[model samples]
Target: MTLTAVMSAPPVTVAPDVPLSEAARLMAEADVGCLPVVAADGSLLGVVTDRDLTVRWLASGADPSAEVAAVMSAPAVTVRADHTVDHAYRLFRRTGVRRLPVVRGGRPVGMLSVDDLLIDALRRFADLLGPVSGSILHDDTEQGFRSPGPRTVDTNGPESPVVGDVMSRALVAVGADASFQEVTDLLQHWRTGSVPVLSGDGRVVGVVSEADLLRAQDERAAEDPARLTARRLMTAPAVTVHPDTAPSDAARLIVDRGLRRLPVIDTEDRLVGSVHRGDLLAAAGRHATDLADRVRFALLAAVHPDAFSQLSVRADDGLVVLDGRLPRGIGADEVAHLIRSVPGVREVDVTARPSGPAEVHGDS
Candidate 1:
C-alpha cells in the first residue's frame, strides 16, 4: 500500500539552471506535465509544470531563455515514498495538485499521479471481482435486489461538502487600492458577481460586489466616482468560507445574508477561490470519477481510518455504493446520509455492518 509499491521511479527531471524552453522541450519529450527541478547533487529544488510554463512564463511574456528556477513552484508539495496510497489521495484532494514528487531523505525518487492511482484502483477492483463473482450470480435474493427507484439528488444533509471541493480555482481578485475602474473592468472580464479584495500580504480584507459598485454609482455623483477605490467601495469584514466549510452552511449563509458570492480563504485567511450559489448546485453533477475521489477523501477526513479501513467504494452510474463496516455505535443510516451530500452523488446505497460481528445490512 505504500507509495514505493506504486510510484514510477527514477523520474524524468530538469536542472534549475536549464532554460524554460529546454524544460518545455523535455516535458514534451517525456510526455509529462511536470518535471522535478533538481540541483547538481540530485537534491530536490522545486517543480515546474506545464501550468507554470503557461501561466508564469508564456502568459506573462517571460523570456524563454530564463532559468527554470525563475518559474518553478518552490517548496514543492511532496509525499514520503513509504506513505500509504490513502495519504497520497488526501494530498491530491487537499492541495488540488495533479502530480506529487515522491521523495526519500529529502531527495526526489519518483512521481505519483492521479492516473497512477486510477490504474491501481482498477487493478484492485479487478482482483476483488474474482472472489465475489460467484456469490453475485447465484444470490438467493436476486429477485429482491432489484434496481433502486428514481431518487433526486440530495443536497440537504448533515455531512458538509468542503468548499475546496466546489470552489473555483481560477481566481480573479483585486487589491484594496485598485481603482474603481480597474475593479469594474475585472468584473466584466471575469463575468463574476464579485471580486475578493486582498491586502498586500494576500489576506482577504473585503469584497466588492456588483451591488456595491452599483450602489456607489447610484448614491454618488459622476464627478466623485474617479476618487473611488476598492477600499472605498468594498464591504469590509467580508463574509467568507474556509476551504473545509460545508457547502450547505455556505449556501445558508448566502441566502440569509443575501450574498451573491462567498470568498474562499485558507488557514491564514488568504484568498484562494470564490464560491457562488451556482457552484453549489452544479457540483452535484461533477464527473463520476471526481465524485468518487471526493467521497473517499471526505470519509477519510471526517471518519477515523479504523472506522473506514475496510471500506470499499464503487460508483455505479452516479450512485455511490459504500460497502464495509461503520465504527462501533454508528448507524448505517448515518453513514448513508453523510455519503449523499458528497458532490455528484445522486444516491448512496450502504451495505455495512457495525464494528463487531453482526448481521450484515443489505442496504440503507
Candidate 2:
C-alpha cells in the first residue's frame, strides 16, 4: 500500500525561524512528538523532534528562546506520498528517524510517524482476525487456523517482515571500556541475553553474550586474569542487521552463526536496537497475521466500493475466500488477481454473484 493510505495528513508544521520554546509548545498542543520545519512556501527544511530538543538543546544548555533552526535536524529525510509503505519503512530503518515528511511536488502534505504505521497495521490485523476467528468458531475440525503467507525462510520474498517490526527497542549497551562487572550488572538488570559492546563512536564493535561472560569467568579462574572489560570479553566483529533487514535473513544468520542477538544499526552504523533469536521466532510466528492483515487492507483499499460494499473476505492457510456480489463489467478473476498480488495469499477464491442475484458463484 502507498504511504498516502497510512500517513497522517494536515501535518502540524513549524517555521524554522520560530523560537524553540514555541516549537515545543506546538508539539505539546498538537500532542505530537515532532514537527516538520517548513519554509514560508511550505518546503520542508528540517524536522525537530522532542528528542532533538532534549538532547541537542536543553542538554547542551542552549538558549530556549533561540531559533529552532539551531536545533532542528537538517537535510530533512522524507518520502513522497506515492511511495509504497514498504519503501517508507525502508527509509525509516535507514535513517533511524521516527517521522518522515510526506511530500508532493516539494511541498509537505503529511507526516508518516511510526505510530501511524502501527495503528494502520493494527486496524488491518483486526480485519484479518475478525473473519478468521469467525470461521474458526464454525469449524468442527481440530485443525487450527493458519495465515496465508510466505514463511521466514523466504525473507528474499516481497513480504518479509522488517527488523524494525521485531527488534527490541529497550536497548541495553555496554561501552568497550566498561568494566566486566558493569557489563554484568547491565545484563542482569535488563534481563537480556547479550549486550552490544559499543566503541567510543557509539557504533557496535562487538557483542558480549552470556557465553562470553562464562568463558571470561572460566579464564579468570584458570589464572590471574588481566582487568576484564567489555572490549576484552566481547566477541569482535559483531554480526549486525540494518533496521530494514528481513526477519528470515536475520534468523538464518543467528542460527547459522550461533549468535544470541543481532545488533540493529542505521546507515551510519550506530546501534539502534537488538533482535534476538526469540524475537525473530516471534516475527516468524506472526507471519500469517501479518500477511492476512496486508491482504485485507490492500484489497479493501483497492477494491471498488460501489460493487463490493457488502463484500466479505477471509484468509485461511494462505487461501483467500471472497463472498460478494460483483458490479456489471467487473469479473471475479480480476478481483482475484488483485488479491493474489498480496504477498502471502496462496490462492484467491472469489464467490462472486451477478449484480442482482441473491445466489452465490464459484464454490460453496
Candidate 3:
C-alpha cells in the first residue's frame, strides 16, 4: 500500500512566522507530536515537534515569542504521498524519525507516522487471523467443546515485568495550587521535564511541563511569573497508567501520546511513581539481556553439552541470534523454532553448521 492509503490527510500545519507558544498550543490541541511548518503557498518548509519546543526553546531559555522557524528542524526529511509503505518504512529506519510529512508536488498533503504503519500492520494481521480463528471456534463448537476466551497475562507472574518493576517509586509531584516558581524548582531539582499535578485529595489531576510553563510565561508576560499556579498551566486529565501496566504498553502510550513521562497510580488513583521514556528503554534493554540468558539456558538443555558450548547466543531488542556449529542430526531451523517458542522472542536467527572433524589430506 502507498502512504496515501494510510496517512492522515490535511495534516495540521504551522506557518514559519507562528509563535513558538502558538505552535505548542496547536500540537496540544491536535494531540500531535509534530507539525509540518509550511510556506504561505502550502509548500513544506520544516517540521517542529514537542521535543523541539522543550529542548530547543524551553531548555535553551529561548523567547517563547520566537517564530516556529527558529526551533523547527529545517529541510525536513519528507516522503511522497504516492510512495509505497515500504519506502516510508525505509525512510523511518534511516532517518530514525517517528513521523514524516507526506508531500505531493512539493506541497504538504498528509502526514505519515510509525503509529499509522503499525496500525495498518495490525489490521492486516487481524484480517489474516480472522478466518483461522473462526475455523477454530467452529470446530470447537461442532465437537461440543467450549473454546476458552482469550488468555490474559498474569502481571503478578515473574515472567512479565510490570510498570511497578521499572517505574521510579520516588516521585516528584506538585499540588494544583503550587506556584510557578515552586514547580520550576521541583522540575530542576528532580531533573524531569514534567511533573504530575495532584488535586487536594492527592489524586493526579494533570501534568505541568516545561513547555507549559514557557507558554504560560509568554501568555501572561504582564503578570508575575511566580503567581502562576500549577492548575492554570497543567494539561488537564493527565494520561496515566497503573502499577500493573505492562512496560511495553506504557512505552507505547508514551510514544503514541508524545509524553515524556506517565504517572503511575494505584487502585485509589493516587500517584505512586512515574515512568519515563528512558526508564522504559533501560528496562527493555535489561529484558533483552535476560532473554538472551534464557535462550542460552534453553539451548544448553536442548542440545548436547559440547554443541551448546560451541554455540553463541546474543539478543538485542528481543531479536535473538544463535550462531556456531550444531551436532549431527540437529538442524538450524529446528534450533530457530525452539528459540522462537520462547516468550518475548520477537525473532530468531540461527546459523549453524553440522559438526565434523577436519579431514587429513592423503599424499596425492
Candidate 4:
C-alpha cells in the first residue's frame, strides 16, 4: 500500500524561526515527539525532535529563546506520499530514523513513523491469522484434543544469532556520581542517544537519556547545572536484556518500550554492551544471506555434484526456495526436509523435478 493510506496526514509543523521553548511547547501540546520545521511556503526544511531539544539545547544549556533551526536535523530524510510501504521500510532500515516526513512537491503534507508501519503490520497479521486460528481450534475440538500446558520454546539455537553476536561491545557508560557535563560530553563524543548509569559495583542502575537530561534542565532551573549528576537525572530501573536474548526479542522490546537503544547485561545484571534498532535490522538481513549460503552448502552435500551444480537457492526473510532437477533417488519432499533441517530456515519451497534417464546418467 502507498504511504498516503497509512501516514498521519496534516502534520503539525513549526516554523524555522520559532524559539526552542515555543517548539517544545508545541510538541507537548500536540503530544508528539517531533515536529517538522517548515518554511513559510509549507516546504519542509528540517525536523526537530525531543532528542534534539534535549541533547542540543538543554544539555548545552543554550538559550531557550534560540531558533529551532539551530538544533533541527536538516536535509531531512523523507518519503514521497505515493511511495509504497515496502519502500518506506527500506528507507527506515537504511536511514535508521524512526520517523519520515511525507512530502509532495517539496511541501510537507504528512508524517510516517515506525509506529504506523508496525501497527499496520500487526493488523495485517491479525487479518491473516484470525480465521486460521479459529479453524485450528475448531478442528482440535472436533478431534477430541485436549489443552496443552504452556511450554518453553528455545529460540536461541546455534544458527540463530543472539544479541551478543550483533551488540556493540565497546560500551560508553557512566557512574551514578558522574557530573552532568561529563554525561553530556560522553553522549556527544559517542554520538549516542543515551548512556547507562552504573552502580558502585558496575551494575546498571538507571539510564540517562536526552529526555532525562532535558527534564533535569527544565525542572532544576535555579540549581547549578554543573552540580547535577547522573543519579539526579537518570531514569531508574533501566529496561535491559541479556546477551543470550534473541535479536528479534530485543527488537520487540525496543519497539514496545519506544526505546532507541538497549543495554546488554550479564547474568549478574552488569553492563556488558549495547544494541540499537539498526544493529538488529542489519543482523536480520545478514542472517538471511547466511541462511541462503548454508542452504546451498546443504544441497551440495546431499545431492550429486552435477545436480547440485544445476540447483539454485534463494532465501529472503527466512523463507528458502530451491529450484532445479533432483536425482532419481531423491524426491522433492526429501530435499525440502533437508533444507528445513537448517536452523535459521523458517520455510522451504522446492520446485526440483525428477531427472530423466539422460539427465541422471551421462547418456545422449
- Best lDDT goes to which candidate? 4
- lDDT of each structure? 0.66, 0.65, 0.70, 0.71
- State which candidate has the highest TM-score: 4
Q: List per-candidate RMSD values in Å.
A: 18.1, 16.7, 13.7, 13.6
The TM-score measured for candidate 3 stands at 0.55
Cα lDDT of model 3 by residue, 128-201, tens digit: 11222211111224333221122255558557556688899987899999987787778777766689999999
Better of 2 and 4 by lDDT: 4
TM-score of each: 0.42, 0.41, 0.55, 0.62
2 versus 3: better TM-score goes to: 3
Error of 4 at 88 (Å): 3.9
TM-score for candidate 1: 0.42
Model 1 has an lDDT value of 0.66
Error of 3 at 84 (Å): 4.2
List the lowest-lDDT window of 10 residues for candidate 4.
129-138
Lowest lDDT 10-residue stretch of candidate 3? 129-138
Backbone clashes in model 1, listed as residue pairs: none
Residue 357 Cα positional deviation in candidate 1, in Å, after optimal superposition: 23
Sorting all predicted structures by lDDT, with the top scorer first, yields 4, 3, 1, 2
- Candidate 2 worst ten-residue window by lDDT: 131-140
Give the clash count for each candidate: 0, 2, 0, 0
